[model samples]
Target: MIFAIVGPSGAGKDTLIRGALAARPDLRLVRRVITRPTESGGEDFDGVTPEEFARRQSLGHFALTWEAHGLSYGIPRDQITGPGDVIFNGSRAALPEAAQVFPGLRAILVTAPDILLAVRLAARGRETAQDIRSRLSRASFEMPAGIAFRTVINDASPEIGIARLLAALQPVRA
Candidate 1:
């Protein structure tokens, strides 16, 4: 099955997904495609130039794609086809398109109040304040009121947020 972990930046999306993977080895998380360079100590997609990404997209190499922070991001279709529980960080606006590809995909919206999110983003030191603000404004995380296997969790510490997300997803097991 497919699961998406979505939220504003600094909402602990990566931490939650990592913890869930650790707790559930059966989960095979999808890797994303990115145009930005990966940070020295963070997990991210291998960077590819925009031209290369465009070529691949034209070749139908991505399941879903979006642009953020002046870079292009994509989730490869092959990654989504794998077995076991799957988790991905993605845009909520793209959920419907993803659902078209994987009918049973579920979305978990990880959200926090703006002030906290701002602090968290600042602490990361990876983005300028203006960039963070722009991302926050442009990023989408709204899911329709009612949808199966979909839920929301408030932003807290990584472990805390992840635990909440885990709790939210546990009941949907087949």
Candidate 2:
């Protein structure tokens, strides 16, 4: 199964995914292809430019790619070949196309109140105020409707929030 976890910037997405991986050794995670420069201590990735990304996409290098915040994000189909279930925390904007390519796909859209989101962004010390504001202005995340998402976790209480997400993976009772 493919599980795509997405939320706005500063929504504790990378943190939650890392924590979940530590807790659940059985889970598999996919690193994304990005145009953004690699930052210290951030998730690992190969940097591709818009032109290179477009060239590669034409060659079918990506299972999916999307434009957002003046950057390109991609998920290569090659990585989705293994049997283990996959987990990725990325842009919701990447979902529409990504889901269609991978069978058994699901989404987990993480979100918090706007005020809380800003606070989290500030705490990260990664983005300038202007950059953060531009990201927030994208308004890319909202409750995903009609998608077979496992669950939506509020980051207010992260420990319990992750537990709820893990629980949602289990078979539901009638």
Candidate 3:
């Protein structure tokens, strides 16, 4: 199963996944190909230029792809190996498409109040006030009908969010 984690820019999706990994080494964290610079912190992804990303996408290297915040992100076709649950930092808009690729895909929607999201985004310093506002405005998304999913409110610490994710994944694991 591919467990795709989706949320707004500063919802701490990476932070929650980092904690979940520490607790469950059996779970795999799928690295993504992103247009962001490699030096940018948070999720560790293969950074590529727009040209390189386009070339790779054209070669059928990616199983899923999406654009957000003026950047492109992709999940390589090879990353969708069979069997165990593989976790990925994914976009909310692409969840249905990912589910189509991995039929047993489970979505974990990490979210927080708009106020909290704005604060967290500001703290990251990755985007300006205007950029953060734009993100916050489009924060909510309607999940594709019938896609197995659960929502986790990451309003507090990463530890709390991790616990919620683990609990949500328990039934799916069983």
lDDT of each: 0.76, 0.73, 0.87
lDDT of 3 by residue, 49-97 (tens): 9999999999999999999889999999887786667899998888878
Error of 3 at 45 (Å): 0.7
Positional deviation of 131 in candidate 2, in angstroms?
A: 2.8
TM-score of 1: 0.86
Best by lDDT: 3
TM-score of each: 0.86, 0.84, 0.94
Q: What's model 1's lDDT at 53?
A: 95
- Superposed Cα deviation of residue 19, candidate 3 (Å): 0.6
RMSD (Cα, Å) of model 2? 2.4
Q: Residue 78 lDDT in model 3? A: 89
* Candidate 3's TM-score: 0.94
| Model 2 stretches astray by more than 4 angstroms | 138-140, 143-145, 172-174
Worst 10 residues of 3 by lDDT: 165-174
